[model samples]
Target: MKFNRQKREEIITSKKKETWGQEIKRNWQLYLMLALPFIYIVVFKYYPMVGAQIAFRKYVPAFGIWGSKWVGLYQFERMFSHPIFWKALKNTITLSTYTLLLSIPIPIVLAICFEYARGKFFRKSVQMSAFLPHFLSTVILVSLINLLFDNRTGVFIHIIQNIFGAKVNVLGDAKFFRHLYVWSGIWQGAGWSSILYISALSGVDTQIHEAAIIDGANKWRRIWHIDLPSIRPTIAIMTIMSMGSILSVGFDKTYMMQNPINYDYSEVLATLEFSMGTAGSVPDYSFAAAIGLAVSVVSFVMVMITNKISKTLSDNSLW
Candidate 1:
């Protein structure tokens, strides 16, 4: 009788909801695991935001960040009025849009291909080959591009001359800048990018695919109806991420690939930021900071807008 009473009380206690603090205490190990990331974010991400004030201040190195004169939006006004700024902005948008447009679908298709591929060894070898290029540094990749596309001794140059009856400066030509940039990026990143989709696809229930098979669904129909819907949320998330970075292209490869002839087409916000920030004897740190801040603001706004649209159109969103 006493044991029965104790069992009843234990059952009641187990049914009771945990308070926030109590739950944290119970899952302290998980919370402990999160502490490092929380600290890192606060230190590296949030802390530097204080220095973003340099964008508004005429940041004289002699006077330091805070001691410098606060000129409000003068830096932004200067940036906006510059023709080079406009050119850089246009190039940045064009390159990023091309990248984003191709980045999304290619990865999804590649991941699906990897999933449906037969023969374990063949799939692994192909995936490894595709992913290997991702580890190459930007400088090395640029060097390889030079070697393969150089106007004089490049292998492709001979083919181009043979086919077109004229020598084309593939490396130095302004017209080829965007093509080389976007396509090389696709080749380098497509496999690495597909990893997330592959992970999401792997988690999909096999029973669902089997059931579809039983219902007379061909591979195409099954992929269209089953695999796609299962991974729709992942696709939505990737789309939002790509839209968020629509203005922020990387610096190293673009800078390395850029030469005098292609500067007009290749100049982007990051390269512009570098040139503005370190422009010889009298570097305009304030203007550079302003440009950086502007890019970050635009990126953030893109993420928010994309997230809202995603939420409205579908059930998946970052929030």
Candidate 2:
């Protein structure tokens, strides 16, 4: 069969194009599945990003985002010189660090306990009780805390005075604010967070455990060798993600719990931003934006650094 070279090449290219088109058509449902998420991202995420320009502008509500006067890095410069900004930044870091240290390991420990629980009913009940607080609104949680720890006629104070003839002001003190916030966060979130680890643990191969048992490995040995190895990837991934989000401590709870007495210790970037938004004769849009941008940039850098470290150390990373 004699074939023209140019015609053969054209035919080959045409066949490739048809194959590609058919593959796309076959996966049309997948494309459709992504449509809603794509639309959501475009509408809620990307669309709002247009206003990020306000970070660079002296935003005026009357003039709108585009009409605002450009102020360059004037806000950023001012932020660097502001003492309150540094204080807020430091507070944010300290709170985040405390929360990370206290909160991250708790879910893992809970997952291990739940996995080892003798009775399914007991385990489920415990899990349900533990997870209940996570569903509570920050306002409700704070109110509950306040009620329990109120300096006057509080349940905790009453118990302390009755049992030990001592009165302790739990909420009014600055020293206890971070502890309260972090411990409450842990209590609320640990069980919910353990759900992922529990799922990962469930997916671990039972055959491996059986094999370890056959080898006469003890329970702790089996867990250390088989279970730990199986879940290490999940742990690494969660650790990296947790580290990346270390700066993003619970803003709602912190803001709600903060009072003038505890402001010295409790004031974080989010609360500072809130104060900046509501303070003065007019809104300090530039200052707020600068503060926000600085936070976002730091968070991004932290995530990148965490990912890099995770990749280097464990060969597991978000990227």
Candidate 3:
């Protein structure tokens, strides 16, 4: 068109700005959709972070958040020196590790099994049955466990007594607490947790399987090569998420299942925090806050490290 250089540049800039304006208009709904979650994070998660300062202070309820006296890391120092804090930390770590070891692979295995099931009916039934426990309230679940394992007259105890003539107290013994807690957690959650993996697996292309079949690939070969690859990223992401929660062993289950005899093994950070906050004549808010902060920091670091390792090993990372 033999336009002047200045005029040409102006037209190009105008066109680029128009394109950007159109993009903003097109994606405006997405930004709007994200607004609520953004607000929620700020309101619920980030906002409460201001209270983390109490971890380093002699947090006085009367003085309020800002008016509280700062003790620097004195609370943290006390937490480190406290034997019960170490015990709770050790117990928390032990139980979390046990639960993770028992629970993390379960959903993957269940997903694979369900994927390979012979019929839709069987798969659906299995999935429904497995997922049903997750619907139960923790109180109800604990009640059911107690009913089934009641030392004198419970079903499991009866069976053990009949077979081995040994009356085992499942809830009363320190040794059995971790096993019972972790295994029950796995049983309650594994099936429901598999739902995500199953959904991810469902998204895998059927055409890939058809191609593998045409190439005379066996069922195992197709699954090993195709199915696993399809869900690898999902597994990686879930594993990273799971690592982040390794210190957050559920308080309800442990607290409900615990008794005086089993308290040594069953005490975890959450339970300790609860007891420290509520059991005494006066609540030790600062101490509890310090412990909570420590747990959160450790969990966050673990997740970051796990995500880094996953990124290094695979092509996927949560970041």
Candidate 4:
């Protein structure tokens, strides 16, 4: 009787194991669902990476990508030697740093505050207003910015000029570029970004909150010990993801906001590459490719380093 039971258990265990092909056949619907996105990524995303080899070549329109002369690191050398490269790098880093400082904390705070909002009506109304801006196209948003911050006819400038007897060209002034960029970004993104933290907060145990309340813990104390910690992992993951794009600040917005006066502060890597590739007398694809590749490399390194630090410090990371 013991031998017969052992044989039966062995047969069940063997039957439970599945090969890769067998699993796919068994759950064909799930694999079918995944196929569309997999093909889209390969075709639209990975396939284009093949052209990145142009960074090493002196691409000529007549010669084509493959027939172009392999100039090796010459494009990189030229890009680094150009004064605009360093200028753009400095502006990009400064702008992105300001954005990171505000973008990371503001959403978290917004989420926390809204979670404990006193009234559902007020909370939903304010959240909808905040989120509406995010749906606006970059061009429309920039156009609105230009209208509102115009040096002469702008509503804001008119108010300031009347109140202080001084004119402020918010868009034209290089000094105000970072301020406008970061603040506008907060306005557009904060509400939408807060949704992740809100989701995290929802999963926190209600029983624990009840116990904390019974023990005489105040709202602030409960939040400090409970809500904040509950969303800490989500915050860490978001930070790691943000680091991946730290160097690639929004191209369309930055380019649109730029004017001759503010070019010094607004010329980020994306715009720089764009101008190099298209704005010049003859498009320098190789140089532009080199700049983009460098930005990508640095951003990737930053992400890895941030993930390592987060893993070490809080045991929460993207990995």
For lDDT, candidate 2 versus 3, the one ahead is 3
lDDT of 1 at 107: 95
TM-score of each: 0.88, 0.87, 0.87, 0.89
lDDT of 4 by residue, 1-319 (tens): 9999999999788668967888788789999999999999999988767888899999999999999999999999999899999999988988898899989999899988888989999989988887898899888888888899988788999999989999977777778888888888888889999999989998999999999999999999999999999899999999998998889999999988888988888999999999999976779999899998888889999999999999999998876
- lDDT of candidate 3? 0.88
Tell me which of candidates 2 and 4 scores higher on lDDT: 4
Model 2 residue 275 distance off true place after TM-score fit, in angstroms: 1.8
Writing each residue's lDDT as its tens digit, candidate 2 over 182-219 gives: 88888888889998889988898889889988999998
Model 1 TM-score on a 0 to 1 scale: 0.88
Taking the tens digit of each residue's C-alpha lDDT, what string does model 1 give over 1-319? Answer: 9999999999679658667888788889999999999999999998778888999999888899889999999999999999899999999999999999899999999999999999999999999998999999999888988998988889899999999999998887789999999999999999999999999999999999899899999999989998999999999999998887888998998999998989999999999999989988999888998999999999999999999999999978998
Residue 31 CA displacement from its true place in model 3, Å: 8.6
lDDT of 3 by residue, 1-319 (tens): 5578889999779777787668778789998999999999999999779778989899778898789999999999998898898888889999999888877789998998999899999889999999999999999988988889988768999999889998888767779878888888888999999999999989999999999999999999988999999999999999999998888888888889888888899888998888877777779988988888988998999999999999999978987
Instruction: Report the poorest 10 consecutive residues by lDDT, candidate 4.
Output: 14-23
**Which 10-residue window of candidate 2 scores lowest in summed lDDT?**
241-250
Which candidate number would show the highest TM-score if scored against the true structure?
4
Q: What is the lDDT of residue 216 in candidate 3?
A: 100
lDDT of 1 at 134: 98
Give, for candidate 3, the lowest lDDT window spanning 10 residues: 15-24
Candidate 3: regions farther than 4 A off = 1-40
Two-way lDDT contest, 3 vs 4, winner: 4
